[model samples]
Target: MKTLAIVGAGPGLGLSLAKTFGQHDFRVALIARNQEKLDTYMQQLREMHVEAAGFSADVLHTAQLEAALARVKETFGPVDVLEYSPTPSITDVASVLDVAPENAQFQFDYIVRGALAGVRAVLPDMLAKGDGGLIFTMGGASITPTPMMGNVGIAMAGLRNYVSNLHEVLKPKGIYAGTMSVMGWFKNTDETPARIAASIYEMYEQREQGEHVFEV
Candidate 1:
């Protein structure tokens, strides 16, 4: 079975992604910072008869993140799909006027550098196979800047740009790269995590390139 590795996995979209792909016969490898939560997530997935495992690693620490991905490959073969979407702590966020150098660096490391590490860890295998998917998720601030999300927006915008370019460059090589830019989370609408995950799966199946936006 193919493997889907979700970096920065959490209870929200991460679990949805796992279920969506696992149902389709993709063994799921979830990477996060907390092993306890990871165990809970794995048990939930097992209850649903999905082949899933979890690895604990912090995105800010690229070494641990890369090692986690390496473990995923060792356990489930090479990762056929890599989804990098780690949620940043609210404390790390700051407005444009108030954003500090430390905050900016933290966001950059969490968002942009973390993604690069993930790709570097998995892309080689994907390229050798000539078939794989690289999916990235970011907030709407990445597309349309919000002053309140200044530091995060900066890193997110860079991520979008990087993924966009990667999509174009990898298109001819029989690989898929795309970005999902969500503007906001509307609680009482059709924009649930499962729905968004289904959409992402659809995009992966279609091998669509560039960005897919989910607006309010």
Candidate 2:
């Protein structure tokens, strides 16, 4: 079975994504900073008859993140699909006026550089195989500027722009790269995690769209 590695796997969307892909016969590698939570998620997926494993790593630390992906690859073979959606630390978010250089740098490292590191870890193998999927998740501020989310917006926008370009560049190689931008609160009725995961699964299967904005 193909492998799907979720870099920022959590209890909600992460678990849903695991089920969506696992149900489709994809082995899941859940990556997060908390081992206990990861274990819990892995157990839940297994109970549902989904093949899943967990890896502990903090996105902000390149070594840790790369190591986690390395373990995923070692366990599940080259990752056929990589989904990156790490949530930035609260301290990284700053208002427009209060966005100091340090805060901006932290956000950039967390959102942009961290993603690059994750991609680099598995991309070489994907390139050699001539087929793979890359999916990134970000808030609405990434595409639509929100002053209240200054530093985060700046960082996420950078990632969004990069993913857009990556989509075009990787197309010819039979690789797919896309971004999912969430607009409004996901807690609302129209934006449940399971629903969003289904939409993402469709995008992965179709591989025609470069970006999808989940709006409620």
In candidate 2, stretches whose alpha carbon ends up further than 4 angstroms from where it belongs are: 188-191
- TM-score each candidate: 0.96, 0.96
lDDT of 1 by residue, 1-216 (tens): 999999988888899999999999999999999999999999999999999999999998999999999999899999999999998877788999988899998999999999999999999998998999999988998989799998999999999999989999999999999999988864422348888899899999998657898764
**For residue 175, what is the lDDT in candidate 2?**
94
Off by over 4 Å in 1: 186-191
Residue pairs clashing, model 1 = none
| Cα-based lDDT for every prediction | 0.91, 0.91
**Candidate 2 has what TM-score?**
0.96
RMSD, candidate 1, Å: 1.6
What are the candidates' C-alpha RMSDs?
1.6, 1.5
Candidate 2: deviation at residue 25, Å? 0.4
